[model samples]
Each structure stands twice: as structure tokens, then as C-alpha cells.
Target: MMRFVFSLMIAVALSPNAAIAQDKPSKAKSWNLTGQVKARFDAKVVDMLCEVSGGAACADKCGGGTQQLGVVRKSDGRLFPVSKNGQPIFSGAMADLLPYCNKDVEVDGLLAGEGDIKIYQVQLIREQGTKKWNKTSGFTKAWRKQFPDAGKKGPWFRNDPRIAKQLAADGWLGLGKEADVAYAKDEVE
Candidate 1:
């Protein structure tokens, strides 16, 4: 009985599972997209800023609408930034994820771009405990269905002059400059 107990204690001390069970939450976590690949992973939607900085108390308070949401991988605790069309800022991803903050979710998407600043162009998202997948963003879906041709020329460049004026004013049109994806990637992260 003494030998058995000592062996069990040594086993527990060296077990990887035991180590992981006591591991602290990941800090300084970041995602990289060195290759184009499709992946689906279970994660919790978290505010990247708060999750890495020990801001647990503020996690729920920072709504998806206010903070850029990222997926904290259930397996490894790494965070991957989500976006649409390589544009996270204006892609409506943030607002679409407002309902999923702090929830366990399955994300399906193509990881695009190179280096640490990559975009996971989310093709689908589904709550893990739920049965259905949300393939289309509700906000963009309604707009696309309502005006099929309005965005045929590109969503930012509409035929309506008033809409054009508003887009320009809002800096969505990019004005006299192009939104350089490479530049943006280097600038962020």
C-alpha cells in the first residue's frame, strides 16, 4: 500500500494533464496565418484585449459591438482574430458577434494573409451548445437580399449619389486612396 501510494503521487506529479489543469490562462497570445487553409475549431468568443491582460472582470462588460472579438481556442487557449474579406474594422463581424460574446462557439473560415496579422474570414459561426449554424451574417444578409443590384458594382461603390456621398463621408469609400491590405496588416498587430 505504501509503494502504490508513492508511485501514484509520482505519476500525478509528472502527468501532462495535471500540469495543464493548473496552468494559468494564456497571456500574450496571438494568431498567425502563414498558409491558406480552412479550419473549424471550438472556441469562446472573447475580447482579445481583455483576455490577454487579465481583465476577466471586464470581459462581459465589453460587448462585441464595442470590442473586436476573437476566438479563444478551446484546445490550446490561443486567440485568432476574425474578420470578413480581410477587413475586420468595417466587415460587420464585430456587430454580428455581439450576441456571442463569452459563449462557446464553433467557427468555420479560411485563414488568409501571412505572418502574425492574418484574417480569419469567418464563413460560418455556431454556438457550441446549440444545434444550428449561422452561415450568413443577419445584417449583411438582409441588405444583400433587399438590394441585389445595389452592390453589384461593389458594396462601397453604389449607384445612388446620396449613398455615395454618405459612404465617402464615413470614409468607407477610401476616397482618393485605396485600402492597402498589406499596409493594414503591417500596421495592425
Candidate 2:
């Protein structure tokens, strides 16, 4: 009986859950891009300025997508500024993370950048303790809401009337028709 009890204790002590209970942060699992890695971790969304300054009014200062947002790893308190999302050009993760500002969430995405400049590209997120994962589609949703007349068949930039108007006014090279003609002539030569 004594030996059995000791063996059980040892087994429990060496278990993976024991390490989790101690609050050790999990490392990224696999490499996705040249400098990006797949990571899933619990973090608290925060306003970058407020979080770095140790300000207690982070929730109020987040500014509803106006101010920059980031996540602080719950296990290690490391702050990762979320700069992008799983979207094409001119898109950002701010809209996705803004609603959860100053709250805990589970994030699954790619971690990119190096040295002192780390960026978290949120691909999926859910409030802490929630079972349903929300896709990081806030940028597209917002764009559609703002530009209801924009067709949905192609890339957002190509479909955007504002960009189309600008391109038409400035020509393809944005340096007037003369420059565009000169560039085309040079290309043909």
C-alpha cells in the first residue's frame, strides 16, 4: 500500500496538467511562415499605451478601434502588439480585438516579427471560457458595412470605388497621365 501511494504521487507530480496548473506558458507549436509560428495562448487584450504605462484605465482608453490594441500573455505577461489580421492589403486586426479590450481571451494565430518588434496576427479568437471560436473577419465585415454597394466577387481593394476613383484621377502610377504614358513607353522599349 505504501509503495502504491508513493508511485501514484510521483505520477501525478510528473503529469502535464501539473505544469499547466503552475501557470507555465506554452510554446508555439509549428512554423507557418519564414518568420511566423503557430501559437494558441490565453491573453488579455489591452491598449498598448495603457498596458505599457501600467495604467489602470485600459478599458476606457482603448477608444473603440481608434487606439492601438494588443494582448498580454496571461502566463508570462509578455505584450504582443496585434498589427495585422488574416486579410489582404490595408486590413488590420484592430477591429477583431477591440471588442475584447481589457478582457481575457483565447487566441489562435501566427506570431511574427523578431527582436523587440513582435506582432500577433489573430486568426481566431474567443472570450476566455467560451467554447465557440470566432473567426477574425471583423475587417471584412466592417468594410462591407461601410461600403454596402461594393460588390463581393473580387478583392476588396479592386472592388472599392474610392480606390477606383483615385486611380482614375491619378492614373495607374499616381503621377498623372503623362508619367503613366512615359512608363508604358519605357516598358515597351
Which candidate ranks first by lDDT, i.e. highest? 2
Identify the runs in model 2 with alpha carbons over 4 angstroms from their true place. Answer: 1-32, 56-61, 88-90, 151-153, 161-177
- Worst lDDT run of 10 residues, candidate 1, spans 21-30
Query: Which lDDT tens digits does candidate 2 get at residues 142-163?
Result: 8788899998888788899899
How many clashing residue pairs appear in each of the predictions shown? 0, 0
Number of clashes found in candidate 1: 0
Per-residue lDDT of candidate 1, residues 1-189 (tens digit): 999999999998775421231122222112344545565677788887788777854645455366777777687776677666223224447655667788888776665565434456665678988877675355555445555666456553355455667766654535533554445666795
Highest TM-score scorer: 2
Q: How high is the lDDT of residue 2 in model 2?
A: 100
Alpha carbon lDDT of residue 114, candidate 1?
50
C-alpha lDDT values of all predictions = 0.60, 0.76
Kindly report which residue pairs in candidate 1 clash with one another: none
Global lDDT for candidate 1? Answer: 0.60
